[model samples]
Target chain A: MLQAAFVLVGTIFFAAVVLAVFRIVRGPSILDRMIATDMLVATLICALAAEMVQHEHTRTLPVLLVLAMTAFLATVGVARYVTQQDRPGGPQAEGGAAEGSAEGGAAGDDAAAHDTTSGRAAR
Target chain B: MSAAELLDAGSVLFLFAAALLSLAAGIGIVRFPDPLSRMHAATKPQILGLVCALVALGLQAENGATVAALVPILAFQMLTAPVSAHMVGRAGYRTRHLRRDLLLRDELADAIDKAHADAAHHDVEPDLPGLVTDEDTSTPRP
Candidate 1:
């Protein structure tokens, strides 16, 4: 039964990792990629715990602790940098041009136009 | 079943649940339309999934020392997940990475606009403490 459980959990984790990797590679924005990275890390932590449980060991628990403690730094650092880039005075204000193609059905131009108009109204 | 077998069974169940949450997060991150939505997708596995995983580890631990060592992992995850999510969500909003049309309500934008209006009435730049400038929002560059 334990062996069966491990196989089942391993298959699920494998599928989850694949999906997260797909999002990371296909991101239209850095933030999307960052979010996917966060998910991937969480999955990693869970997988580590699953491994420890299966092997009946605690050696990897410290790795789990370190990962949980530091993973947020990447998200926070990227977010700060993105906000800085968005500022007019900040370097490379036109950073959006390099931002890969939009995901399907989003109509990037229409969204950009709507955002500017609404933003103006807000201001 | 013996007590040892019962504990093993419980640990397997908990681990299974955590893996399922990870799978859900994977699907959510890909399918969600925008950064903020994707952030929502990522947070569940970061918190609840970690909790379930750690609980499973604790159950399978051979001694109190091992279980004690698991506490800090859960604590750190709980402490940091929201901080990172908030920062990312704020950045996403400021950078026009969300689907404005899909939003039923945007309290942050309304609040920012209200602050802007108030600052404008005072005849000064819309600068509120902790609130950034409208320059970022003035142009949509997604």
Candidate 2:
């Protein structure tokens, strides 16, 4: 019964890997790709953990730590890079565009984008 | 069922749930319409799935050493996942990948505007303590 459950979970993990890969490849924006990549590492960790349960494997635990750390650093590094982007006017222009959408009366969804850009203000 | 069988059953159940949650998170990343929403999918369920799977492994751990090790692993995951996701969210917002239409309440508009304005006169962090003010502060800005 335990083995069977492992197999079932393994199948699910396999499907998750395929789907996450698709998201990474098809993700439209750089940030979309980043989000997909984050999901992929998470799926990998889940799959590995499931395998550890099935095989009675207790030796390879450090690999999980290594994977988590790598994912964390990579994500933070990229995020810092994106936030401090060198483009002088890009963030401002986008901010303006978001505001314009708010005032121009596309109020429903546009407000979300506007408010998030300046989290402090909305508070 | 014997105690051993019951233990295995518990581990199996946890692992199964973990796998399904992981799959759902993956599907969320693929299907969510925007970056922020995709972030919602990416971090929360994924962390829960990781914890579930790790807990299952801990349940089956044969040695005290193994369970001991598992303790710190779970702790680290709980600590790190959100920080990474938050950093990503910040990057996405600054980069403007966030879809305005899907957003519910963006608290940062004024901060970004302040930062935008501040960029001209001096180098200031958009979220510098004084930069962001309450709603009343939104008015009277030159």
**Which candidate leads in TM-score?**
1
* DockQ in order: 0.44, 0.41
The parts of candidate 1 lying over 4 Å away from their true place are A83-110, A113-123, B128-142
B81-141: candidate 2 lDDT, tens digit per residue: 8888898877766545666666567778866676779885686544443221334222322
Interface RMSDs of all predictions?
Answer: 4.2, 5.6
Residue B23 error, candidate 1, Å: 0.2
lDDT of 2 at A23: 78
lDDT tens readout by residue for model 1, B1-142 = 8998998899999999999999999999888876778888887779888889888888877789988888888899989888889988878766666666677887877888887899889988876444434454445445
Clashes of 1: 0
Q: What is the C-alpha RMSD of each candidate to the true structure, in Å?
A: 6.2, 8.0
- List model 2 lDDT by residue over A1-123, tens digit each: 556667778998888888878878765556777778888888888788888877887766898877776777777877777642221112334554445445543333344354444332322
TM-score of the first chain in candidate 2 relative to the native first chain: 0.63
